[model samples]
Target: MNALPRREAPWAPTALRELRRPWKLATFALGLGWLLYGALNYGIADWDVGISLLMGGLTYLLASWSVGRLAQLRRPDAIGLAVALAALFAAWYCVDGVYVLYHGLAGNRMDREGNFRASLLLYFLAGMIWFYRGGLAELRRDLIRLIPRT
Candidate 1:
């Protein structure tokens, strides 16, 4: 029996291939932005910087995994998944904000160090999520190219 010709996915365009190379750079910039925000807002506390670095590393890992999964799945709806992830991130931020407000109402000091630390972490998470969205957008564009036009 003759072997079937290997199908090259039409959506895997060279432009998309080039885009993947910049993801790491984008991630790095995101990490740096988080660090700068923390330094500016919190005055470079040791623990805050350490936690921000740790969170940035975690964000990078999550973004890498999501990108890999998107590449493996040729479906044109990866953008939906990206949007869902973004929503989840925002929800978490809102919950955290409410918690902080509750603590403030409970008579916690307004200038508590912990609150500033938490804000640093939140800023880091926000920057990382923004970068992740950028990467997802590129992936979505590639997936869109895969759909066969009628």
Candidate 2:
């Protein structure tokens, strides 16, 4: 006999189910925000802008899916995916911070525009950290499960 419990109904769509998790939801939301921001600011008039936004948005969705898989199975490939995402976000944080600081300090007065950009970037970083923590906790839990019981 099958051991798994039967579902009452067909499962929700993959993206919908995965995004039920808070971390996943945050990541997805931020990604959409960026996509919309790009569309609005860049107008998608040029081929480069259109393609870049398309690719970036798709990548974010894939990353969200990876986060969900990591949470459930702690898959080996998912670990690598998480590490890559972490590195990407960390690098972005560093470069953006340096850019904002240099420009903000270059002016005699405080740069409000730089301040706004920095704040948005900080929120994005925080979302990534939150998503990373959820994956890390799942990995830790699975590792402990593998230990031989006394």
Candidate 3:
């Protein structure tokens, strides 16, 4: 009689096991980069900028937590969580960018014009990249489950 292969149960990975998931690590790094860039370019005195920063920090925390939960039973919902957070951040940036552009058109300080646009672009790019990575990871996991073992 042939022996059947053991099935691996899905459970959140311990801190020691997290390193094995490269996608999670990459997501964390991307979040940190966004946080740092936003901090350096914008002063927190403005309420709009302050709120955006706060949300960015919170999003990073959630992404970190999700990394720990990666091994848990296929939570396709994690991707949705990450995407929602990213969309929120992007919307915030878009609103701020429009406000800044309006002021600039009115002949206000044009010094930070380029910086503002660059920051908005960077945030958008980061969000998209994270979303894409999460999607691909989910798809890969699904594919793995579909393959039959000999």
Candidate 4:
């Protein structure tokens, strides 16, 4: 008897799926909170908090997308270029996070150490890496299954 071909369930893109993660949802919520806080307390002058949060969220999404795209590229030179771009993106985020955290600490009168902001951003960075790896795995698996066997 002949075996039937396997059918897999339809799924969303890896980058979009990353947004559905619990931690990512939390980050979006936190971004909204920052937006609200900045608007109510100090207007556009203090908009950095909200903007940083939004950027952080976008970074996670884009990193996942990058990993997914990287997995599909066939050329060695293209892969190397993609890797370099990804690294540069990550480094930029790190520097931006530090700047945001520094400004946050400078603005806060009561919290001299800025421990809370630092820790929160740190957690988000770790979450971004986690999301990227998860997306890579999922996309690679799908790509592998798409390959035709002789």
Candidate 5:
């Protein structure tokens, strides 16, 4: 008989291991480069740019934690679908941000009505996501129960 010894976990990576990943390190370097470029071109006086980047980074990392938790589910298709939809949302926001920033720098502003409409649309989309989160949580619970323990 060659039965393996019982282990207690569901073990995951250590914080250090996560930080040392090559992809993570590369992203960190890229982020620093972007910050350096921004400082040089936009100047250190641009609080908006700095704050925006910081907030975006925090949001991104926090969101990853949520997704990482979901990654444990047996049915991974839900995770993939969530990622795809979120990517689309992020892409739309990125394009809109670029458009707005370009116009702003060129001394033109976004049309007030259009901006308001877009804001409303974004709000609705976010609301829908908030609603969907409940279902995702329920699904996670169900899937976890379905997973057989060692």
Candidate 6:
């Protein structure tokens, strides 16, 4: 009887990994480009704007580094399935962020919030996708089975 999730193609690069180098760079560029545009057009005239942009860019880079780490772990990864994983991450991040920063986010800084959210949303999504498709779930499933099932 199969008691645990089977590990298939355990060391394959996931779809998110395949897109990692490209997506990370893309998000970084996209975020920074918007930051620059806002500064020039509107004005980096506020601390929140700068802070938000910095966080967004940093997260995208962090997300990219994660993909490399997963490969080092020799995890199995996938692509089409990765999209679902990405969306899951994005949803989680957004919800968590709103929950934690609800007070601050209630202010009238939708522009900065929008810019940063776009970058962070993409970064979180990609990283989670990589983890999900890159054998992360396998590790999780195995761990879950360690518990006594009623």
**Winning candidate number (TM-score):** 4
Worst 10 residues of 3 by lDDT: 1-10
Model 1 ranges with Cα > 4 A deviation: 1-20, 43-47, 63-150
Q: What are the per-residue Cα lDDT tens digits for candidate 6 across 20-61?
A: 544445645776676567656765334344444555544543
Candidate numbers, best lDDT first, in rank order: 4, 6, 1, 3, 2, 5
RMSD of each: 12.2, 13.2, 12.1, 11.5, 14.7, 14.2
Q: What is the C-alpha lDDT profile of model 3 across 7-107, one tens digit per residue?
A: 21112333224333577456656665665666567554332444445445434333333322332324447654564455455455453554455455655
Worst 10 residues of 5 by lDDT: 1-10
Each candidate's TM vs. the true structure? 0.31, 0.28, 0.30, 0.37, 0.30, 0.30
What lDDT tens digits, residue by residue, belong to model 2 across residues 59-147? 44443333333334434465556555654453444334433454455542434465346444643444344334334457468668989
What digit string (tens of lDDT, one per residue) describes model 5 on residues 38-131? 6467543432354335433433333333333333334547655565456445434433554456456756535535544643353333323321
Instruction: Report, for every candidate in turn, its global Cα lDDT versus the true structure.
Output: 0.45, 0.44, 0.45, 0.48, 0.42, 0.46
Residue pairs in candidate 3 whose N, alpha carbon or C atoms collide under 3 angstroms: none
Q: What lDDT would candidate 2 get against the real structure?
A: 0.44
Candidate 6 runs further than 4 Å off: 1-23, 43-53, 63-150
Record all residue pairs in model 5 with backbone atoms less than 3 Å apart, i.e. clashing: none
Local error of candidate 5 at residue 79 (angstroms): 17
Residue 35 lDDT, candidate 5, scale 0-100? 53
Using lDDT, give the best candidate's number: 4
TM-score result, candidate 4: 0.37
